[model samples]
Target: MKKIVSLYSVAILLIIGSCSTNPFTGKKTLALVSNDQLFPMAFQQYGQFLTENKVVVGTAEAKRVEKVGMKIKAAAERWLTANGQAAVLQGYQWEYKLVDNKEVNAWCMPGGKIVFYTGILPITNDEATMAAVMGHEVAHALASHGAQRMSAGMLQQAGAVAVSVGTQNQSAEKQQMWMQAFGLGSQFGVMLPFSRDHESEADMIGLTLMAVAGYDPKNAVIVWERMSAKGGGQAPPEFMSTHPSNETRIAKITSQIPAAKAEAAKFGVVFK
Candidate 1:
């Protein structure tokens, strides 16, 4: 059974999706989960999330969220068209929502579904900073990180199932051990860290997008600094989780600022 499943997974991965090169980082990417298959599910999930959550409408922050979303969308389209990647974003139907929550969280899902919790608005204090945030979130969708995550999850699940099948007939103690291993391995190895990498990649892409959209890319550095400062009162050590440390993320953004500015020059940005 395990062998059959493994063979099936390999075959499916090989045949279903064509691998593509990432424009931002030039990395090879496997996209087994097509946008056509993933977008509808993401749209449904976004709707469900909004219905379940406290969606704040007709507010300043809500309007800001929409404004930032539009700017980022324009920036994304400009970047794609400039790079001849307009086809990659051809089917995106972008929507951004502001949900009244205090979790200091924001996300963009596949097919351009995005939501910003009101709590994080304070961290993104101004339009420029907010553009940084929106740019980062939108970049995740443009880069297809969600689809990559789903593909990773499928492979992780297949691995867990194989291990379980291999040990199901063993002693009770062995079965318990395998179960724990499966849980830990699936999460830490496949799910958790992958999010952080995608986050960083999105950061790079977002910085450029915001810069091209006429917001200073330096705002990306400021946004991360603000985000880091907010968590200073009580936050996990950056290495303990999936997110990059504020310091590290800020430094990387700073280093990339020159490139972002240079790229924006093609869009008629004047250096101060």
Candidate 2:
């Protein structure tokens, strides 16, 4: 019991000590791992990924990916500067690459390293739609969601340890049952919701970012519409998934378009 109490106390203190406010959302988040520590590792991993993949360079599609990524990066910088959060991106080493892969996906690693798989370009047929996806990916890095995820994972692991320690005096069968319960509870009840919230937050931030980058905010909805159409198969229920359902995302993005456009107007980027 004392061990369990001590573990809980340490976890609580870690949470309190590591809290940082997200510049875009103004919400406090766990950041137990500092970017100074995380960025170097992320940069190295990105380098290794590029070394292993067939990077498409010196092509129209590759140039488009770099062009759109730069626009989104500049827009993020401008918005952060205007909002007095420029320091949040101080360690970012921005790089954009197009890799020859069949998976329709793109991602931004911590410290602004972005990769676009060639397969996704068919869906992002133009600059505006590409900006939408780039903005979303970049927003994930900007918000420090990766660090937050690591912090949460640490907490979940600590919770598991606490369960084991607390149940040590009980029967082996009882301890095993509690461990299984802890695993399921932490994953479904905590981690999944946490990840989905991050996705939704990225969507909101991405809409404003694409608008600030001179892309029509409403096109974000169109981008997602294309995404949904391409996904002819079914997805797991939203409760068990890491992303919001397509219908939920479309509705949210459509409703937020007016506000995103207004945000862009502050930066002298007006949409017709």
Candidate 3:
């Protein structure tokens, strides 16, 4: 019994130590891998991806990607620097590429690598809307959602191993069912919900960043309206899906508009 208790205590410590706090949200977040370890891997993988893909250079779309990305990154730098957390990006190699893909998507990798697909341009429409989207992607990187996802998966695997060991003498079929149950439970409960939280946080932060960067925050709501319309007459409900854009989110943004406007003011921004 004493041995089992000690093992459980160690497990809890591992869990706590694996987490990092979000400076923006003041929330503890899972990050099994530290940036010291993760950033190098992310940077190398980003380099490899750029090399393998048809990375557009000295093109209109490429220029736009870099323009919007730099603004958002500058805003992030200001926020981080003001908060005295400049060391968070000590080895950051910020690169923005506009890949020639029509997937209508964009993403930012850890350590400040970002990509925007060309197809997303139509919906993004203008610089402000583009800022909104880029801000959202940049926010994801700052929030470390990918790192958090990896941490959650690792924790789930660890828990499964612990359960299997604890019930080793049980039937194999029972153990298998337990494993499956654990997997699904982890996905639907911890992983999916955390993913949504990250998206929402990104939306909030992105809204403010774009506004500060002299882009209208109202375009954020419009972007989501278009995103919801893209659901193709069938979606698993915003609450059920990973990306949410139903009325609730729109309403939330509307509610936060005043504050976003205030943030923009600090940067000498006034919506046009």
Task: Indicate which candidate wins on TM-score.
Answer: 2
- What is the model-wide C-alpha lDDT for candidate 2? 0.93
lDDT of each residue in 1-272, candidate 1, tens digit only: 46546755775766356676676677877676888999999889888998899899998888988998898899788878888877888678899899888888889989998888888988887889889989999988888998887777776676666777777778989978987977887576657778778888999999888888889988888887787788874766654567777877888899999988898898887456
TM-score on alpha carbons, each prediction: 0.88, 0.97, 0.90
Over the full model, what C-alpha lDDT does candidate 1 score relative to the true structure?
Answer: 0.82
TM-score order of candidates, best first? 2, 3, 1
The per-model lDDT (C-alpha) reads 0.82, 0.93, 0.79
lDDT of 2 at 41: 98
TM-score of 3: 0.90
The Cα error of candidate 3 at residue 15, in Å, is: 2.3
**Candidate 1 regions with alpha-carbon error over 4 angstroms:** 1-18
How far residue 103's Cα lies from its native spot in candidate 1, in Å, is 2.0
Prediction RMSDs, each to the true structure: 2.7, 1.0, 2.3
Off by over 4 Å in 2: none
lDDT of 2 at 139: 98
- lDDT-wise, the better of 2 and 3 is 2
Give me the displacement of residue 33 in model 3, in angstroms. Answer: 0.9
Write candidate 3's Cα lDDT for 1-272 as tens digits. Answer: 34434556777898887778886677898878877787899999998988888888897767887898889888878777777766665767788888878797888888778888887888787788889899988888887877887787777777767766765677999878877877788777777787788888888988888887777888888887887787575767654677665566788887887888887777677764
